[model samples]
Target: MAINIMLATAMQPLGFLSAGWLADWAQPHTSGPGRGAALVLLASGVLLVVWGLAGLRYRPLRHLEDLVPDAAPPPEADADLDAVQNRVLAA
Candidate 1:
């Protein structure tokens, strides 16, 4: 977990740098062999980021909440129990 956090912190800046580079590469009035390669990179990066976020959508916190009960706070748990009891009685 610690290593993953550290690596992410380091790599986070690289993503920004890559975006900056791509923006510069594809800036208006610039022409070269791969005229739109930067745009391709931009699309690819966006896709990869979206994919990564989707993959970790439920585990960003990497906590027991994702895999266990007792996720609610104590006060909330009491309220939830009361609500359930009321529903059961009403039904």
Candidate 2:
């Protein structure tokens, strides 16, 4: 749940990131349409570098579960025993 929340928080900033990248790309680098695209491409390359440095620090949300797999199932009878013990102790 915390991982999902963290990802949601990160996603909120990505839109502004993408827009800023687009703006940088669309600006006239050399006063030509092709130059604009090239500038955008260059900006995108920088974005990739920045994202790699930051995002790589944490496994993306989809991959978080893979980082720590669920443990094996506990013994069913043991679980039942634990429940009964709790009830008796509570009483």
Candidate 3:
């Protein structure tokens, strides 16, 4: 939950920064808005290709399924209040 919150908080600012960078990069080279859009698309494609190659080269990423353990099932809920209290006290 905390990790998700942190990621959500960071993503918007990072997005704005990337958008600013793309605008700065595309503005000088392109004549029109359409050209700038095309440049952004081209940049995205290149980034995707690089990301794919990186995933291929990284061994841990490739073996992630084997490395990480599956989550344990949750404990069953106790209905009786006295029994629950006793278990809690014992623990």
Candidate 4:
């Protein structure tokens, strides 16, 4: 969709900002810039692979309703308080 494309396009600057923050604040002194760069590269590669797989799939893997039942009501609470009151009266 257009919205997804727009958001993906806007992510470039955010990614740059995150990379800069990682380089400045999060990166370790001993491991240095190379390690920081490697992490960023690995993360980007993973994102690309996931995005490609999702894009290639024409239909949803499964519908939301297929995963969860819509009509079944939630379980009711117990009558423990009533039982406690009855026990107190009998005692």
The lDDT for every candidate, in the order shown, is: 0.72, 0.73, 0.80, 0.70
Candidates 1 and 3 compared: the better one by lDDT is 3
Comparing 1 with 2 on lDDT, the higher-scoring candidate is 2
Give the alpha carbon lDDT tens digit for every residue of 12-62 in model 1: 888877776776667654576555566757688899999878777756455
What ordering of candidates by lDDT runs from best to worst? Answer: 3, 2, 1, 4
Q: Give the per-residue lDDT of model 3 (tens digit) for 9-80.
A: 989798677875786678779897667667887887899899889998999988988999988754544367
lDDT of 2 at 48: 86
Better of 1 and 3 by TM-score: 3
Question: Once superposed on the true structure, which residue ranges of model 1 sit more than 4 Å away at CA?
Answer: 29-45, 48-50, 53-91
RMSD of each: 9.8, 8.6, 5.9, 13.7
User: How far is 83's C-alpha from truth in model 4 (Å)?
Assistant: 91
TM-scores of all candidate predictions against the true structure:
0.33, 0.36, 0.56, 0.44
Q: What digit string (tens of lDDT, one per residue) describes model 2 on residues 1-90? A: 899799979897886678656756576546755666577667769988998778667657547778887888656655688787798799
Top model number, TM-score: 3
User: What is the lDDT for 9 in model 2?
Assistant: 92
lDDT of 4 by residue, 11-74 (tens): 9898888886765553574375577667767777999999878866735443544756667543
Highest lDDT model number: 3
Q: Global CA lDDT of candidate 3, please? A: 0.80
